[model samples]
Every structure is written in C-alpha cells, then in structure tokens.
Target: MTEKSMLVVSAHSADFVWRAGGAIALHKKNGYRVKVVCLSFGERGESAKLWRKGPDMTIEKVKAARREEALAAAENLGAECEFFDLGDYPLRVSDEALLRLVDVYRDVQPAFVLSHSQKDPYNFDHPLAMHVAQEARIIAQAEGHNPGQKIVGAPPVYAFEPHQTEQCEWIPNTFLDITEVWDVKRRAIECMAGQEHLWEYYTRVAQQRGVQAKRNIGITVKRDIQYAEGYMRLTPAVVGDLS
Candidate 1:
C-alpha cells in the first residue's frame, strides 16, 4: 500500500476527474488517501452541461445536480470529496477565504498536493484556483515569511493538465504509472453524467499521454492500455536519493 495521501485542489467540480481521475484511482487502489477541494460549485461557465439538459433548470437545481455528480465521481474513484462553495466564473478570493483553504491543507496534511496549472489562458477560474492552491501550499509550511499562514509541513505540490494548458508547454516534472488503475479512471469519469459527453475525449487524452511516455527507454510500459495522466511539480518531491 502506498503510504502517502494526496490532496486535489480543483477550480470546479469536474476538473479533478477530467485531469487526474487515473492518478486518483491509482492512489486509492494502492491504499493511499485522496481528498478533493472544489473551489466552486461550477455555477457559471461549467454548469451549462447540466442546465442544458432541461431549459428550466434553476441555478439551485443545477448546483445540486453538479454536487451529486462530484460526489459520485469521487466515490467511484474511492476518494472523499468536498465542495467549498466558492464563487465561480470570476473567481474572487479574499485573504480570509484563502486562509480557510490553508486550514484544509493543514487538516489534511497530505504528502502530495495536486492542483490546476496556472497557465490556462481560456479559463479564468483555473488560474485563480492555481493561485489559491499555490499560496495554500506555501502557507501550509508556516515558514518565517508568512506568520499568518496555517501551521503544517510543506507538502510536495504538482499541477495537473487542462485543455488550453496542453498547448501551453506543460512539462511534466513527475510521472506516476496508472496503467493498472485505468479502468477505475474510466468508471470515475463515467460518473459525471452531466459531462458524460467529454468522457471519451478525456480517455483519449490519457492514452496519448501514455504513448508519449513510451519513448523513454529502461521503463517498460505496455502499449495496450489506453489511459494515462501527467503532472508538473510546483515544488520538488523529495522522495529519496534520486540525485
């Protein structure tokens, strides 16, 4: 069993599953703890998938459905999920709110923190989430620079891929093999009925990533699998004597 747990900081409800469902499922199957912090209920730019199902869908109804989908997806991946109820679209974060996010990091005290990349040119919330997550990660250490930060160890942080981010030079500093857990990833993605339309596309994204990884020698990776995930480290992960 993997001893370390991971905290996933997402801009919206479905972003986590879309980017790292394979990784999340891989961790869970290895007995690692997984927690998701959704910065928003995906009220604005992201809720269209649900609201479009019925023209009369109210804001409250759409939110409720999205939450259910998030929970179901997390359950499918064997991880605990929580929604922060933060504002969507124009993601505004106050110092107080960011500190609350710090509290989550301290409370969870995860060894690994995964979040959205900061370079998403198209999505406003994605960059905001990245900022909050980056601050929370640094603050979690409670170093001398920021006395207002929550007291916790500085966990290793990584950024997951996004749609626009793929073309924006995402150099993965770390890689985790998710071949065995690919099926779990597929199932977790299937839980998002509202966004079911994009599931296959995401699956293909993973497969493409796997193919890219195959070029590296001395790492025997099977080509039959059709799913993979990638991440770039925000800070170095001191695992052992890699140097």
Candidate 2:
C-alpha cells in the first residue's frame, strides 16, 4: 500500500508552524507523511525582530535564520520542508515557480492540502499562497501538463486559521482535535523564536477553538477536546451517510 501524505503550502517560513502545526503533528503521529513547502523565507516582511538587530542584519543572515527555525519546527513535527527562497514582502511567483509547485503536487499526491485563507486583507501574500497552491493542484490534475506523469486526484483543500478571521472572512467549518499532539505543536511553535510575540496568541487561539469544538459536538460525545485547530475546507466531501 502507498503511504498517505499531506501537503502544506506556506507563504512564509513560519506560516505552517503558526497556523497548522497541530494538524501536522497530529497527522505525523497518525503515520502520515507530511510535506511543507515554504514559498519564501519571509526575510524582509516577517523577520522584523531580526531586522531590528542593528544594521549588521543582512537579508542573507535573516533568510538563514528563518530557514533554520523552520527546519527545527518541521523536525519537531516530523515533516519534510522545502524552501523556495522566492523572496517575500511582495512575493512574486513566476510561471517556473508555479510549475515547480505542480511537480510537488504530482510527487506527493497528498491526501489533503493545507494553505492560507482565500482572502486575507491584512496580508496579500497569504492569499496569494493559497491561490498558487490551488492553481498548482489543478495543473497537476491535468494529464497534458506532463504526458506520462501520474495525475493527482482531487484532494480536499483546507484553509487553516488566519490571524484575524473576521477581517479575512474565514470561517472554520472543520475542527481537528489536536489535544494529543498539542505538546508537539507547542515545541514546534517555540522553534520560531523570530516571531516570539505570536506564541501565546496562537496558544489561546487553540484553546478557544477547543472550546468551540467541544460545544459543536454536543454533550453526548465522551471525548474531551482540550486543544484544536480550525480549518475551512474549500472542496466538497462525498459521504455515504449524513449522520
């Protein structure tokens, strides 16, 4: 039997760590192969703390630091990470880069794809990443893209939680109970020292989502959910039964 895998397309190095760390860790524990593709190191935009370290902080240095942090985080979550180093703060994806992502789609043939919300007013890069991820998946499904290559199936695409869901118009229709893997996710979050300010914020987000998840399931379920990650599934799920 082929190994099941999941893909995560991140706008920046720390995006997957912050938004989908719990999902990654939980899936990894469940024996799924996790692959993370970071479009950029977020050196210019997301690495503000590094940039504030005087004039000695160069772009190369910042990129290296971000890459190291992302690597550590991925390791903690048992994921394999690939960096595009495409640059950020106005991330531009060339046709070549898009095709490269399509190759990943074909190779991994992920069971599901995780990315940013379709609309994020605060950060244009976030939405663009999701756009690219969806586009690549479509291309990978087209047999003409690469004649003999195996075509990927229609894997469900999910938008992980955004920083500000209200402004982004992102609603969580799926909640993953990540209580068992929360510790692994927390360790991964700590690996992102460059964005220390958001550590506690995401923790609270998990806690809030956990409460919401518990409420949604009603009182009949005996499972106690203490930590959760929310996702907005962008694709249709075929089911045999509604309940």
Error of 1 at 41 (Å): 1.7
lDDT of 1 by residue, 19-49 (tens): 9888889888877888899988787778767
- Candidate 2 wrongly placed segments (more than 4 Å): none
Worst 10 residues of 1 by lDDT: 217-226
User: What is the lDDT for 185 in model 2?
Assistant: 95
Alpha carbon lDDT of residue 194, candidate 1?
A: 80
Runs off by more than 4 Å, candidate 1: 1-3, 143-150, 218-226, 237-243
Using TM-score as the measure, which candidate wins? 2
| Candidates' C-alpha lDDT | 0.79, 0.96
Clash totals for all candidate models: 0, 0
Residue range with the least summed lDDT across 10 consecutive positions in model 2: 84-93
